[model samples]
Target: MGDTRGISGIGDADDIGDMGGIGDAGQVGDTGLSDGPGQAGDAGGADDAARAEDAGRADGSSGGETLGGRDALLARAVRLRESGHREEARTLLLTLSERCPDDAEVAYQTAWVHDTLGLEAEALPHYVRAIQLPGLSDDDRRGALLGLGSTYRILGKYPEAVATLRDASAEYPDDGALRAFLAMALYNTGRSRDAMEILLHQLATTSQDPEIARYRPAIEHYATDLDATV
Candidate 1:
């Protein structure tokens, strides 16, 4: 399955700051606090402020600059992936993960690249690492959980898959996509009744969503077959 999470444009304040002189400080002030040839001093102050701002922007000091070397590398890897250079992107992400073993974003992006490359075995540990990252966004954590569960399901680890998907569903209880994935995992694990229940719940809650409606036939088919089996 593709990444269910939507990708938004990165809005690094550093990049904006790098554009130079976008702030009012670079413009001459009319405060009239000084009298003797104050224009030169004001111009000099503006130049200094502009230079400092440029330097800060180049060093990525704005917006708290919390992302470390590994995160930067992973971000570059993501760019490569977006450009359709999958192999190079995978290599960059893997290198970043190796370089910064404790960086969660590095590991997370590595796993994402592995999944894109169909390297399920290599992806599982990274997904687990991503979920364990402290203060990860709920959306990111849920995505990692779903990815892990889906990978396990593909590998025939049905019990693990079900447990992982269940955990993800609990974390994102209102997520129709997570619930749908959980239902599929349940069905694959021989818990057809549970799958039917999940499908029915999804149908009830998301009847108006065109994407959910598209799955109705398969859900109904599964529900009917489950009823017959029981």
Candidate 2:
């Protein structure tokens, strides 16, 4: 539901399909992955905001190190982002990332905010740091992977996108969103057949449309062997 303007070489939202269900929420199949040419970097929507609010409300009584009410600041940033005050959120997150350079959550949120603002180039390092630093939750790690790879693609870094997406797909095999983005990256890299194969396989197994369902077996049969004879 965010601004979905297209970048050069990347299709608009209608062309790329909605990627709101990529990571942290659940499997891509569970969310009904859509098809398209572009990838949405907004991985988790309300779930992210809710989680940040919950964390902010925590008393931090646990033995974990509290960097001067880091949770509260992170929650504030999430609120700003969810509320569509992205410029304010980005500025705050930049400061937070500097103050809490070692905080995975801060780095990840910083990257996400940057991506939402169409600053994918600025987001790269933060996404990498979030993934590299300890303390990132498993769900967030998955989201970061998808975000990083999709960012790479948007920036015209095709090889990097392919590599990052492939690894992400391998790690989260059941995530159809990963495969969908991976397919896009593959197509950009001139592997149209491979991309179509991935899309076909996903459609065959996941689609609920009556026509696709009726031809599921045939689609599956041709998924990998697109050039096969009858």
Candidate 3:
């Protein structure tokens, strides 16, 4: 089972967020989001980060503070995020985004910071933009798909969540995190049995693959819980 759901379980959104393997395993917001073929922000209590630097840059207030060159800006933004300085990161990334609206990475990272800030409404368009761009790393593209899917869920767009997750799953069926997230969305939309069935199938497959068998316990426990709860 290349399904990376870990044997001990579906775990926390905080934990799952780091699954992206983005700037040191790009993370997501904790709770309900999956590193599923997709994953959000309350990381390290980094979730509820300080709004100290929020200067309405997103609205064009401080949008003109040049973040140096593209590479420098990217490096800085990644560092700010890794260090849990999300507000500053968004500020820098937002400026970078306006200067390079066509740059997919800028668009994506801007959205990432917003999602981290629990500003899904703000993150929404950028994620969508990143997804539509022509050139993106396979992982980053998947990240966008996963991010947008999770964003839709957070925004109560269950149908969009289901659709987007399903689309990503089709492309990466081996991604267990993505599968777990799909199950969560399915369950949310009144498809508990369907969700449980998917987890159970993944569990059975994981049990057969020695390479990933280490994750079996988590899957087994989660499956049983799904059986009981849903």
For model 2, the stretches where C-alpha displacement exceeds 4 angstroms are: 1-65
Structural similarity to truth (TM-score) of each candidate: 0.66, 0.71, 0.62
Cα lDDT of model 1 by residue, 1-230, tens digit? 44647433323323332232222322212211111221222323233233334434545554112243233334445655655666666765665565566766666667877888888888989988877876456566667787888888887888898998898888788877778888889999788888888888678456987876888777666655565655
The per-model lDDT (C-alpha) reads 0.61, 0.67, 0.62
Identify the candidate with maximal TM-score: 2
lDDT value for model 2: 0.67
Candidate 2, residues 190-222: lDDT per residue as tens digits?
Answer: 999999999999998999899999999989988
Instruction: Kindly provide the TM-score of model 2 when superposed on the true structure, using C-alpha atoms.
Output: 0.71
lDDT score for candidate 1 against the true structure: 0.61
Q: Residue 60 error for model 1, in Å?
A: 15
Compared to the true structure, candidate 1 yields what TM-score?
0.66
Superposition error at 215 for model 1 (Å): 16
